[model samples]
Target: MVAAALNGGGGQAGEALLTLALPKGRLAEEAAAALRAGGLDVPGEEGEQELVRLLPGSAFGRDLRLLWVRPADVPAYVREGAADAGVTGKDALAEEPQGVLERLDLGFGRCRMVVAVRRAEAERWPARLAGEAGGLSVATKYPRLARRYFLERHGLRPRVLELRGSVEVAATVGMAAAIVDLVQTGATLRANGLVAVEEVLPVSARWIVNPVSLRWKRPLLGELERRLAALAAGEVAAR
Candidate 1:
């Protein structure tokens, strides 16, 4: 299954190959496993191997091209048509520059995009933070969504400080009043005395394609969209 998604298919669909911009971490490996489980042949061991490949098309007319890319870069690759489509987090789509489009969801890489503030400052949550004269200062890896969520939800404009990493350090140095980041287990948040008071969005790895290429690459993207959608639906029931 994982082997097949990485390779190409044959038949009338042969001329048009659907390439996927796959994430470079666990989601890539997990997605490959899921595709393989759904009868897509799995290939490539992602262990020490970082390079992505396109294997030979099989007789059943199932062939796919998978591209290896950083998870954050997946959207731009798909949106630009550098690859036919991609599997990336919803968070990636949210943070992408403007004009983002994706046709379907792969339903993997479950996580949340949340707004975090210092644990001791729980009383100063969304509403009160907005009342301040200068507004609450925020530090986030995702300045785009944070800004959007804050303004839309709180009716306030915050001074957002975009930080590369160590968002907790930003709070300690008073660079920002709080932070917004991806929270999976809340373990890191607990360690830093930061807790999520607001949630921006729920995120998952999804199937994304270029808006223009949707028609030109219908055979590849269309088939994948159907199969993956079904798999995602079934996965929901199972859960």
Candidate 2:
């Protein structure tokens, strides 16, 4: 499956273009800014309501193209060879890891994947989970990670309810007893009357490349990595 996904490359003509799959939100804006700061003139502001944006080769001295996609789909696009590379969060990478090469840590979009529950039920969480007679219930956008954390890591069985959005409201509306979600700040959790119990993993945006693309498009991809690394270093120094 991994091989099949990585082998679907563009034709010879298309292979000459360095296509990048970028998430369509704040992450995209951050990525575009980073590239521009690194001397690659990435045109098109984010949130432009476009699916694809073609950038002129004169700006970066290479044929560059950008494909806007959902954050979670970035890796898939790269893996499937629809794009040579992509930027996505670590949490999304954890959910899907086949046929993708995580090349660099972009250092933005930082957050944590955590286990949280309503504050009122916080005290009962451990004991209730300890009993294990009836399995616990969890709401999350990442069902795979949530299941592994509960069943494998913690040795507890849980009914994982997959939700697209509004995971915090699950506990309030009686959908689930707890939620496994991403938290950049405690504001959202606190606002939802939920308290984080444990952190599943730390998350940040990552630069990922298709292994096949890495092998074939090494020159352009390598240059991109070099520029982005310098940009990241400058960002850290500025902070």
Candidate 3:
């Protein structure tokens, strides 16, 4: 069954389309596959493809508009009500948790957020960091989560250095004593002569919705949630 068009639209009979913010790059392709499995006819390709599309209303009256955007921006777009709902990584949500309801763990884009140091220093780094009165210097894309993990969990004061990308190289280049970053295969860490010392969290893609949109577009959102949840359940069963 398809979901109905959202209210408050200026298009054809004043029905607003349910807008979904999808992340660009790899996750976009995977999310498209998931949406298709859940019964929406989204594209199967990624990159340079149509970034936006409005699915014409079907017999069940489903009208969905999809927007492709940077993964880091998905939360903000949904939170600000620019899109009715979105899919983003759990890491993104953990770093900034507000203004949206995290609905489903999509079970794709799996990775581990970990603390890593050069292999030669791995054995001694923890004790050294603990005794460091100056606080531990850490490089990470997720400064908030890194600080929280070190300060609260390990009782170490962390001086977090925020980097947009290539956090793995920070420790090697002496920018920081340790680095907090995502690792899927640990290949990059090995190549950089670093090893994960502590696992902060396991992360995956998540479904989020604006609170106001949920209230106003409950029926449509609920239907989509049901279909996606069923797909996730089936995936788990197969695995």
Candidate 4:
């Protein structure tokens, strides 16, 4: 049944081929696997040196191109129409400007965006932060999310310190009152003597589409969506 859906369809001969932007990492591999399971001819092995590859005579009967990019840049590529569709985490999607459409939840790379404080200071965070003269100093990779969460949820406008990496160390090193970062297993937080106090968002890889592409290539996009959906459902059922 699934094989028929993917293999039977043939896109228009002269139609523009679709470009899919995939993140460089585990999500990229997983997305490729999913597409392959759906009968698309995605190359299984992604070489570190190569940034782009083309799958000719894909399930759509046209060249399907893949662009490997930073995970954070996937949304931008889709939004700017550099690629018609892409896979990116929900965390990245949250910080992106409101232009692209979230087509499906890919359901892999599950993690949580959380606020963590040093274990010793966990109980006093909200109180201490509220009483501080200036405001709570928070460090995070996701400064936008951290700022909005603190302001909206706690009614405290915190001074957000943006860090590209090693956010958990901010609390232990006394750089900030708390840290916001993605937690997959809580091992890193434990190792750093930090404990999660607040969960900002549950994140997973998602399929995002360009609005212009969806409008012009609805049939092609719909077929791809159906096949991917079936693959995702099978994965969920297996677990």
Alpha-carbon RMSD, each predicted model: 4.8, 4.8, 4.2, 6.1
lDDT tens digits, residue span 1-239, model 4: 32332242233212457778888876877878877776778877544246766556775786776778988898887887767788889988887748899988877788999999999988886677778666689998887888788888998788999988888888889888888899999999999999998899999888899898888888888889998887777766765
Cα lDDT tens digits, model 2, 117-138, are 9898788867768764466889
What ranking of all candidate models by lDDT puts the best one first?
A: 3, 2, 4, 1
Candidate 3: 10-residue stretch with minimal lDDT: 6-15
Query: What TM-score would each prediction reach against the true structure?
Result: 0.83, 0.89, 0.89, 0.89
lDDT of 1 by residue, 1-239 (tens): 55644443321223345566778876877777666665556564453164556554631364555668888898877766667667788888888845446666667778787888777777767655857567688898888888888888877678888987778778756667878888788888888878888888998887777776677767655766777788888777776
Q: What's the CA error at residue 125 for candidate 2, in Å?
A: 3.2
lDDT at 106 for candidate 3? 85
> How high is the lDDT of residue 217 in model 1?
65
Total backbone clashes of model 1? Answer: 16
Q: What is candidate 2's TM-score against the reference?
A: 0.89
Q: Sort by TM-score, best first.
A: 2, 4, 3, 1
Give candidate 1 misplaced runs (Cα > 4 Å). Answer: 1-15, 44-48, 58-63, 97-100, 131-134
Q: Could you tell me which residue pairs clash in candidate 2?
A: none
